[model samples]
Target: MRLAWRGPTMLVTDVRGELGRGVTSTGLWFRETRYLRTMRLLVNGRAPHLCALGGQDARTLDLVYVHPELEQFGGGGSGLARSEESLASDGLPHRSIDVRVSHAVQLDGLESRYVVANRSRRVARLVIDVALDCDWADIGDTIGDREAPVRIWARAVCDGSSLELRSTHPQLRYVTHVEAPGASAHQSGVRWTLELAPRDEVVLPLRVRAIDFEDALTGEGIAAREDALARWRASHVVVDTTGHGVEPLVIAAALEDLASLPLLEGRPREWLAPQAGLPIYPALFGRDALTTGWQASCVDGGAMLDAALARLGRLQCTRDDPRIDAQPGRIPQQVRRGPRARLGDGAFAVSYADVASPLMYVISLAQLFALRGDEALIRPHLDTARRILDWAHEQAQGGFLHYHTRSSDGPEHQGWKDSGGAMVHADGSSARSPIAACEIQGYWFAAQELLALVLWMLGRRGDARALWDSARDLKRRFHRAFWMEDESFYGLGIDREGRLLRSVTSNVGHCIASGIVAQPVIERVVERMFAPDLWSGWGFRTLSSAHPAYEPLSYHCGSVWSVESTTIALGLRRFGLDRRALQLADATLALASLYPGFRVPECVGGYAKDEMPHPGAYPRADLIQAWNVSAIPGLLHAMMGFFNVAPLDLLTIDPILPTCLDRVRVKGLRVGRGVIDLDVWRDRDGRSHFDVTRREGTLHVVRQPPPESISVGIAGRVRALVEGLLPS
Candidate 1:
């Protein structure tokens, strides 16, 4: 599916820019409801012949078509371009008439500008029909099993010039106004009849506006959406690929997706962070937002991460609610406000089942602070951070750092791998609740370790020491509890009764990303991660194929997630696993290239790379997810070995390029109080070189590797710290 979205509203359509009724996921949706479902454009009562369609960008689409009735082309299914194909299929071809449609998504509406030209030396008479319909089914109704309590069909009103379609649900009201200035309105659509002289063209513009009427459409940038898109593109670092194909596509797709993430209708404007993704997850998600912010931080300078933290801080749980797994200072898993969620009926309105969100929040905030060096941005969240730490301590007392579901309606598993059977044992049985997943523990350890540094810097030495104590204790315990000496990889998690899940998984490589794994086991963890059972060649599988519960198409059991591979790659790089990290990054990007528009889905089937030339589609996966979109820049950052410690006035850059990328130029890299532009390129002989073209900050740029304390032996780190080499 290709889409153009503005904030929470998105127009999902086929590659040809046509949206029709009963088409899979084709519609104009606002928030969680599908407003306009069908839009079929026809010329002279016949479908136009699509010449070319470009739907790569997220906010605009350009389609070129020829009047099928007026202009005929040869070949039924030739793989060659029609521009070069001989037009002698029936020899009944007349003058050529081309129709070019340009679609742009405004903040409050969608605009379709069509220009039809009579290129041949003959007069052309053409009739354009735009048949449209609106289905009031929400995302839940369209994508899930929940039936809308009250079905409301749209009532169309035509005034001979424009069409107004309105729907009134039991709990809400929706308005879709179509304005085609010179068109005549019909029963369910609009039409325009025109005659053009040879070499002349007519411009027809159709605008579709959807005002939900509940939360007023902000109308933000409706007048200047085109300019807004241009500015957004100019603001971020543009990666100019030097003689590369796949790398540029992946980076461009990811950046475009991120650029469309800023929300429009919901929260206060001050802390407006980007929503998760379009059509499905278009709301603020605790884990998704935090991770996305961090993942894209290498490119955006942690701007979104900081905003996400502030917004989540403002909406942090205030009191204990067992039904939603809420506790004071617990960051919510997802904040939803659809019709059903607003009524608290089906999906959770706001949940706290994500055991890793609070920890991720802390980590994100710390990373933000480290990048910006402006403590003021993160200092506001100190109290929330401390309270979250306290909550973590409280939950860890009896269970040894784990989580259990308190609400039957919430997710069974709370981590990234939250699928129902994600925590299954080797025997295919479900692991008991309060499971201490390795990634969760890793997040907790990393949070504690990072937050303590921030606290220490903020003059709260006592709390800092306490955080350090807990972090060290958790590390020791995690190593003793989760590590399997025989396999040399960490267990998935421990059951509530202290039994190991005994399933080889991707969490060990993931744990390395968290910097929680002791240095001594890095190689073993690496070895286990690359094993045939877990490494699916394209990426790391969530679960080992040897397990009885492993299914290539399953949500978490064996599906390979771009986000997971990104984390593993980052972790691999953190410990100087350059070759392995590049392998993972190359594999992930290669897999991404096989998908539509080079945008990775939420997850794909964990088939070996050799087994499938294309990515195995994960059923119902979010095609343009923020989680997977960030994987591009995240993996790039990992390969570059980019690290920022604003507090220390240090920015490290160690770039290692893969064979796929010949050269990459990054502009607009933000450091502490400064921005830098740099380039990393490989010579013709394949030797990589790094060059910083611009540096405008006091932040020291160092060409060095990651700190030894990251993956080196913990005992050695402690000894080095004692000897005053530097704090780990």
Candidate 2:
């Protein structure tokens, strides 16, 4: 019963196709304010009998209701225009009528289309009453955690076929328009009457648009959004799975979700830079976009990813502003466009205090350049990347990077697991301010090492070596500062008092992905990763089950995040634990089968496999998260050992196919201007084989990693040709 549809900007109405019906998280919201709040459909003075709800597209919402006692109306009973079997409705078997409410959620507004069909042999008459209202409330208000500002109730003026709503308070003025054909607007709603011939249908449309709002801000200016679903299917990456049971469906679902995230209805089906997710986080998040883009780059996100990086470059902080924790050369955590953000009211208007964002941005640039090999794509952001490095170096104290926030609006914990008390010690003690998380150090190490490789390729040898030296030094100190010898794993982080927050969390797995985990400790880390307390069987839990503060449904304390699982799985693959990595993917995809649309949510319950009938839903999970969708491509790419370092005009594939996926053909995978179609399969003897079904460019396909081990000079690449399995 808790169904919803999402689009650019968006409508969050419930299954009743009405706002404020069963869930308070239902309304037409954009940025920080709810533009339209009240809407309900009535048949003959009372709500119709609800039957079913469905939609195939991400942006479309459909609800079918039955009007069991639809009676003939005369001139005195004028209203809107007008379903079922004997057991389907309360009416007789031959006297059933169906009313379907179809909604097209758009950037500037939403359009509700009512299609009333007479399924019975007799003619049908129905009176439809649509109540409309608007109340301005921030997202915090709907979240119901006492953080939201007061709601703004607008006055409505009704005219024939049109209703105008306007609200003005101390903070802002908001307005919206509602129009429908042949609708007689009353004090706050509209009424319609229709007579349909037997087996006939009538489509009555109602449109709502925000006054003076620009659709171009979030998506294309067009409101109809007719071709969105088609483009999601036929555009960019087309993955065909022959025998991979449900995972292929999950893969296709992920690709569709990624293509539709931006909600653009343009032809040629171009994918533009997108927001973080739907319902909430409808804006560019630095860590989310950078990380997601890094994974999506290997498949079909090259065009939009560079654009996102450029935008992040532009949004990079140029000077110190402690009020928002904006440091010179630091990228923001999230960028917002709502009026509250512009007017300095929203807590996350432009948060920049996150510790991992700058590092992820730099790493994304390195990974993207490796795939695209276009120097110009990253040239514009080099200075920003350098300054970010400088900021990281400046923040480094005693060879460890720490994050602290003094602003009231700034986040308490700066790592990805930033929920309150997420950085707790094993004894359930909170890690105090200026905390240095293990994952941050891993990202820091990767940022420096990868950027150095990029610089070395760009003719900045001396600069690259300095960074490499710094990275090598950090790796040595990292283990000393955070490793817990007894637990055979890295500690969670170090607090201001220099006490390691010794919690056996999943943060160490990220260190594996970054190539920072020591070889001596790799097996131990892997052992701890699969330890009963850490592996939930569905995926890796953020905090081990044995942790004192572990909560199955807690946002970051113990929930199984799809993105987190993908990262950990990739790390396992990098460490030559292919089976373990594929196991993680299989478990994740199996969990994906339980979710709606074959897509993973932001996070699920951290319960073990046998703990519940299904992984309990996290109370605040976003079903269409950007990073969650991007995980599909990352998981697939890892499965094939496909690494594209296009700077050398090379793509190395060392495949070890898992049994679950029998045959996978990837088309439209771009490396620079050329596209590739690759086929990967596993033989009955357990040997992996890949055939380049089609290639359309001057790309040299190899079965080895990029030649990044040029220890001496560019001319020495031949002598230093062999690259290890370790991630560059």
Candidate 3:
């Protein structure tokens, strides 16, 4: 068993309450550098017997252990003196002992508390030792299974009761400080000898700090950290569910995980940026951040989107650099701040392998603009947005958006499904470079339309018309090139030679969700999406099970990604496939409940529902992924059919709740200049009812009539209304 905790960084420990595995993964890491590679505890030259392990919060772990029964009885005492003899005769050991270990992790360091107790009729003596070492390896090197350079070195220095281990390399300098109050420092670590009488106990406290290059330890205690965590949790919208089995728990866990992932300090700027996930990608990723922020728009009232847009704007690529795949106007794929991150010839801190990140950035900004009519927040970034849009236009010169990794060390594939073997033909052979993924085109179409809307709001009619025309042309070409007429489904992508990579995948769902697929073909695509080959009961599989390349446990070929399923569900609702959308939403919620803490993972094994009890776990998936956790809020919004164009002073509600969720209430839902508290419930006759219990501000509520009455140009009408609100 393994236990883990995360704050601004992350720590992982094995069952023995030690980090001495020496494997590529186990250790303390900050800013993509492994700080402490090995740490072990020994009692009387032997490891303690494990009893139980649990965590009270995301940042604390508790472990209970005990010595061997024979060792506790004083090792073959012949005479069995007095009380010891009586205890042995009564079938009890001469001494009963217990060891409890508690680990508390903070933004800057870790504190561990050890308690030893003797609960028998006799006294006991114990020897305790803690062993430690550091390798100072870069996380990328560790994950890639490459060896660290020999220039890296570690040195330990002792000063009285405290010890410090420092690792240095050309790119990074790391230090770990250890302090044990009453213990003596040695070459191995610190040591302690203790004597405890009957029912007596002793407590030992140890502190380990991962010091920043220019900052000193503030010596803040656990109380301060807990207070900070409480404030952070209080900043988000609160949610509660009534008469639901797992809904309340799911909401609570989602909010908690979101609060835990924010970078507390030491970022490029003072603003908070969410890390991708824990124990692995605890760094800023452009795609993950934008997706998470968009999904969390309703909960945070677009605050996440606002911050993400600003941060990405600051980190946007300004020049062409083939070494790191950096191109002007491109958003970074991933950003790491550490010494080893500076080793590359080009700027390695920001890599531009993700072709979809800039499009995601544009979509997120549009989402924020729709939620709040604050042109003031977006006005400053319009120039950056136009630059990204221009880059997209240049890349799509051949009638489709394509990507080929320019950096030798960059990812082979650039879309969300970026694994090496993700893009393959029906024969299981990999697709060639410069591939045009189905979803990238969808994103490009959406981004162009969204930017056109933004331009219209700003009274730039010519620019708006040009963008809309480009979007329309791309949509037409996408329909003609990517649609598989014989199969009644869309192909995964087009290879470099202009041949369709005929593999059925979940990317088609994104096309529908993005409104890139033609209206006539949407129903057919949705029908095929919900068929047995694509819908795995848990969620939508990245690739169809019927495909020759399908492997349930493969990273990208065959996996159920919550984020992808959420996107498809949103798209289904957009196109009026209410029943199918509700079905997918319920399946995603059910999958969340199957995970350990009700926290969704980055991806799960794509197994058929009837064939397995629950979704199989992907071996290396991030357990608390930001986008995956955001799926809860995304699902809620999809089921409720809530959409807002705040600038136009309009709100639309089209309830399509599943039967399982009889009643749903969303309180403190912020939009535009006010908050909305809404309740929707089902009557005995199965009809849905809506009540706006509370509405603040001048928002016009429009309850969508039925499927047939919904006008074909409703989206266009909303955009026009928003444009009309702007001053001429």
Candidate 4:
């Protein structure tokens, strides 16, 4: 079994509580570097047998182990053998023991508590040893099969109760400080010897801290770190649920995961920005952060959204650089900060890939404005938004947003599906670069329209009109160029010379959400989405299973991504396909429930439901992905269609609750300067109804699809004077 815990940093380990060994990507990582590559425990010179392993929360892990039988240790004398036999006959192993190891990994250090209990009737002598080592490898080396170029040398120094292991390389230096009370320092590691009475237990506390070579070491205890974690969790938005099965629990877990992903320091503008995931990508990613912030806006009241936009805006590229594929006004794809991330190597501090990041930034800014009518916050960023728009217009040559990476180390398919061979021709050959992906065009269209709204709201009607016209022209050309009549769906993308790639994929589903596809084409698109080759019953596969390149476990070839599923579900709802949208939502929730903590992974195998009862885990997938966790809130948005029009001071909700959910109540939902409580329930007649149980301030509530509109004040009077206000 594999387990992971992440605070500001992350630690990944296996059931034996060992780091990297034999194709396992387990390690202790900070700032995009592996600080400790090996940490294992042994009892009596042999590894213990693991009985159970799990965690109490997102930041703690526990492993239970048992010692081997005394016979396996080779009985030294006849007396020992006779005692073992006598104990076996009595149903107790005479020399057996049980060990429990609990690990609490914090932002700057790790604390491990070990409890050893002797279960036998005879006193036993045991030696406990902890092996420690570090390679100081760069995180990029671990992603592929590439080995690290630097060699690290470790020097161990024993100082009283502490054992300090300092690792040095040409590029970086760090130290791992270990403290074990009542333990002696040995040449190999710290050792503890115990002479236990029958049924006696020993408790050993070990603490490890990773410090930068240049920074001064401070003695901060585990309690202080845990208190900091508590404060961080307390600052998050709270979601209260009523009449639900696991929905509240799942939401809480997702929020905890998100809170743990915030960067410790070295972020642009020093604002709190969430990394993409743990272990592999504890770095800022533009697209992932933008989407997570957008989904979290309903609960967080646009705080994360605002911070993400500001950070991305600050890192916006200002000049063209062929090495990193940096372009003017383009948002950086990913940012790496550490001593090892240097130029001239494959790892660059800031690199560019897909053009979608800038488009996503624009879209999220519009959403933030809608959630909060804070002109002060948005007015300062209009110039940045306009610069991005200008760059986007320049890239729309021949009527579509196209991308081709100039950097040799940059990604080939520069979209959400950045894996090699993701973009392919109908014959299964890799599609040529400078490819115009269908989803990128959808994002471009959406960005233009939303930015236009932002301009119009700011009294720049002339600029807004130009943007609106550009969006219309792009939509017209998109329908003519991307629609494949023979296949009855949109092509995956267009190649360099403008020939269609002619591969059916989930990318086209994004067009529906962007409102770029015509009304007549929506039914056919929805029909294609539900086809057996596309829908895996758990979620929509990234590539159709009928495609020759399809691989169920492949990263982007034929895997189910929760983030994509959420986008497609929202599109289905936009076109009035409510049943299909709800089906997708329920399937996604079911998949999340199968994993521990109800935490959704980055992606899963695209196996058909009939072939497997549960979704298969994709090897190397990030376990705690941000956008994937955002699916819960995305599903809620689909069901309720909640949007805050802050300019009008109105909260609009057009709820279409799924049949699977009988009732739901949301409390303390923040909208603009007010908060509201909502209660929604479905009657036996299969009709859904909602009530605003509580309201504050002058924020008006608007519900759609025709009920006689009633003033809240008069409605309250009627509710108090007569039987509860009659159902619409």
Candidate 3 Cα errors over 4 Å, as ranges: 1-7, 69-95, 144-152, 168-171, 214-232, 265-270, 345-348, 685-687, 705-728
- Can you tell me which runs of candidate 4 are displaced by over 4 Å? 20-24, 68-96, 119-124, 144-150, 197-200, 213-232, 235-252, 267-271, 338-340, 343-348, 705-728
lDDT of 4 by residue, 474-589 (tens): 88888898888877889889989778988878887788888788667788888888999999998888889999988899888899898887788777766667678778877877
Whichever of 3 and 4 has more TM-score, that candidate is 3
lDDT of 3: 0.76
What does candidate 1's lDDT look like per residue over 175-218, in tens digits?
78899989998768899998878799999999988776666554
Clashing pairs in 3: 171-339, 172-339
TM values, all candidates: 0.89, 0.89, 0.89, 0.88
Name the runs in model 2 displaced over 4 angstroms.
Answer: 1-7, 69-95, 120-124, 144-149, 212-220, 223-235, 263-271, 705-728
Candidate 1 ranges beyond 4 A from true positions: 68-97, 118-126, 144-150, 197-200, 218-233, 243-245, 265-272, 346-348, 397-399, 681-689, 709-728
Model 1 lDDT, residue 532, Cα: 91
lDDT of 3 by residue, 1-728 (tens): 25355545577776566775545566776666666777777776667777778888778878887663443333367333344343332243433668898888767677889898887666777787788777766665655334555335778888767888886554456788889887887755787788788789999888888876644335553345446546545656656554356855776788677666665443233145577786667788898888888887777776666667778888899999888888898998988765556564344467889889999888878888888888898887788888888888787747888999988888899986788999999998999879999999999999989889888987899999999998999999998998899888888999899889999898888888787998887888888988888899988888889989999988888898989888988888887777788789778878888888897777898999899998767886776788888878877777777787788887777776665567777777877886778787867776666777787787776566223222336785564345333211
RMSD of each: 4.8, 6.1, 5.2, 5.3
lDDT of 1: 0.77
Better of 2 and 3 by lDDT: 3
Candidate 4 lDDT score at position 712? 30
